[model samples]
Target: MSVEIVTARWIVTGAQDETTPVIHDDAALASRDGIVLAVGPAAEIKAAYPEATVTDYPHHLIMPGLVNSHHHIGLTPLQLGAPDYALELWFAARLSMRKLDPYLDTLYSAFEMISSGITTVQHIQGWATGDLDEVLGAARGVLGAYEAVGMRASYCYAVREQNRFVYEADEDFCARLPAEAGRVMAAHLARQKMSFADFMTLYDELKAGNRNPRARIQLAPANLHWMTDDGLLAIKEKSDAEGVPMHMHLLETAYQKEYARRRTGTTAVKHLEKLGLLGPQLTLGHGVWMTEEDIEICAGTGTCICHNCSSNFRLRSGVLPLMELQRRGMVVGMGIDEAGINDDRDMLQEMRMALTVHRGPGMDHSAVPTPTQVLRMASEHGALTTAFGAEIGRLDPGRRFDAVVLDYSSATWPYQDPDIAPLDALIHRAKTKDVHAVLVDGEVIYRDGQFTRINRESILAQIAEALAKPRDTSEQETHWLRAQVFGEVERFYDGYVPADTPRIPFQQGSSRV
Candidate 1:
């Protein structure tokens, strides 16, 4: 709209290093038409923007809005009836999840996401079984929900050329199964049948029709095991030609590491490097299994990473080398993945998880995570991974006016040391309930536990009613089929990794002497 001033007790500049960070106490920022105009002391900002409408919070901390850089589905797998399994088997187990309308499902998570101070997301959608048009419609449903909710999103329908289930090719894997089970499994995969040409075409079509100014489109190569050599090359060529970034899932699990070794005769990151696909325009979703050298390659090429901490733990995937990745100068971002530790999209918790999980049993403060580093991952670095680039990350002149106001008094509650570091307190003590308001593009979309653009209660009520029905016959049959074939998928990985193994992630040499 017009010039507006948002003042708070403290302002987190979203800029910091190991021990030093710039937090403005008794500060404010001025914005106009969705762009930040200036930021300085509260009195100076008020005087500078005299005619601007003022929204002042005397007991809140204003910080840049968070970015969930590697999100997938709207509803988490747990909510959709899938139990926690390792990353590989979890894919097969997810086949039985009852289908919900994509629009409502997206809104279900958007509510949680926004309430948790997430204003932007990197939504990498995939695994829809349908024709091109049908799949495009599903993409529309998801993008529409974000638009309706006023959440900025970088949307991509991940391009998966092969290995939809196990590490083997779909056809070859199904061919070895029992005749009856093979047929059912083949039939299940047949629904998702799409050609490589269709993947490129789908990206072009979506890009042309995307009407949301706040939203951007990108190409995702899905995962290393999922893409064939030619398909990976094609995706890289397209990304280079079109100047689009690619958010890919690679080396997420130990099984995936083994799969890469088999397929590429090297590590997954090395495989991408060989293919000439590692660069600034690519953001790897979960580099959990990436070796020390893999981290070096990524850092060398300016490759970004989205650390899905909760997802890795939830799926029993190995922990990411967050400390090493950050130390080697990689632009690592934070993501909740399917859900956070508490099974929701709270970024504060995700940041906390990142902060605490990386602390080794050592007294070296330099090796441990700093509050500013984690905050950067959740805000600035996370935004960098998405198509949003430098447009929506920081709270400063020239950046988009997207930020969260946290009730400092409520967050610190009955007692907090006045001399305590502001960033430390914000990261360690803040909760989703402490979010007083969220602004996107200079507009207050959510404030005082209410969404300004949409009705949260109505959406939640609708979702509850919509999912109240019992499973239909088709859903029941899918569940039975998954049960029948679960053992088959498990058997494929029986000896995937030997009883004795070495060279695990974040470590350089053999595990044993």
Candidate 2:
């Protein structure tokens, strides 16, 4: 059966021509088999598909659904305002406080994301017990929640192996280690001891369960700074072998770049390039600390970068050189980082932040990204990060009908000129509250400020209960250890160049208290 949606005052299809008007005053979009079949004047569409069921969105502006490239769905409730600290200390506190619960994590984050007009998210799944049963179980729970809430996601089991602190060491460590060794020893840990063989098995299992065509699955290497050289190379090889994209955090902070350089005798981008890991299949998050050479390398190798605006400002990580990256022909996507910083996965808010912040001192405001370009970053550029650019970013004929409708009556009224461009108003002036309807793969998943698929209240209640539980912080044993983390971070930034370097100044209108 064909479904026809009409009554959109304006439809921004995200096509090539910025002003190529496709649907005018009364437009309609028809879809069947989850693909857009037609989009044009309502009268013409209705005449073409007489028997198609019609749904009307009277005073709404319709556009492509948002694509969030990098996000941590499990970190939603941790949105506590943690400012005035560098990246390591802030990360330590977050890792210590935020306990992972599959059900609550997905429920709260998915609901917030969909409500905020983000139809697709690339979720970096958090730490899990190194047991296949536990890991796959957690993955299933998250996938189920996303499916239930009608949100498309590229869910990755974040893989890592690291040394634990002395306090976390077992008593048997005394016999296993030499006298010079501390109470703890570096242990070979895998979230799930998934060899390449085991990972393939688990991938197939998860893929089988993903019935929704819109929900994509991929493997993400957590970060180069976190993983060892062997682990990084293995991840790159595995992703290439399996034909999946590899996502990782890169050059997020100046300290991270310095740390990578000190440890590996090369910058993070150069190190990855040396390892043969910088390629089209890679998507690096938070390219704020990238050098010009690094940007050129990424462009040459076809590697993508996710520019996370909110997290950068909140954590005091420097602003990404977005215009330069675009100029070099790199695919730049937008992300909200983890939940607590941005607070919500609102793509419109992210778009606004990206545009405003990138226009720093001595830069032309007009040279910054327009609302349309920002919209493209959240939609098309984001899709490109996950290698789905050609399939899911726009609402054109033969494409998937993933779209969001904004109520223009209240939010966009009093336009002196009818030709004032609804797209501008939607990007700059609109809020999540204005989102009236959302569709994924031709299915109406959200409407009338409520979800069509999941129980929002139930999910919220579960999250509340999870947050109330007692957290375990026994791992952070000594004040010296805590201080060491912060001190290392501080020292790392000692030689930082705030003036000579390309930097985005803090916004004058920031909500700093």
Q: Against the true structure, whose lDDT is highest?
A: 1
- Cα miss at 180, model 2 (Å)? 17
Q: What lDDT tens digits, residue by residue, belong to model 1 across residues 359-459? A: 87667888888988888898889999988899988997999999999998998888899898866897899998899999889778899889988898898
TM per prediction: 0.97, 0.85
Each prediction's whole-model lDDT (CA):
0.87, 0.71
For candidate 2, report its TM-score: 0.85
Residue 173 of model 2 has an lDDT of 29
Q: What is the lDDT of candidate 1?
A: 0.87
How far residue 186's Cα lies from its native spot in candidate 2, in Å, is: 8.1
After superposition, candidate 2 runs with Cα above 4 Å error: 15-25, 75-84, 98-100, 163-204, 340-342, 362-366, 414-419, 469-513
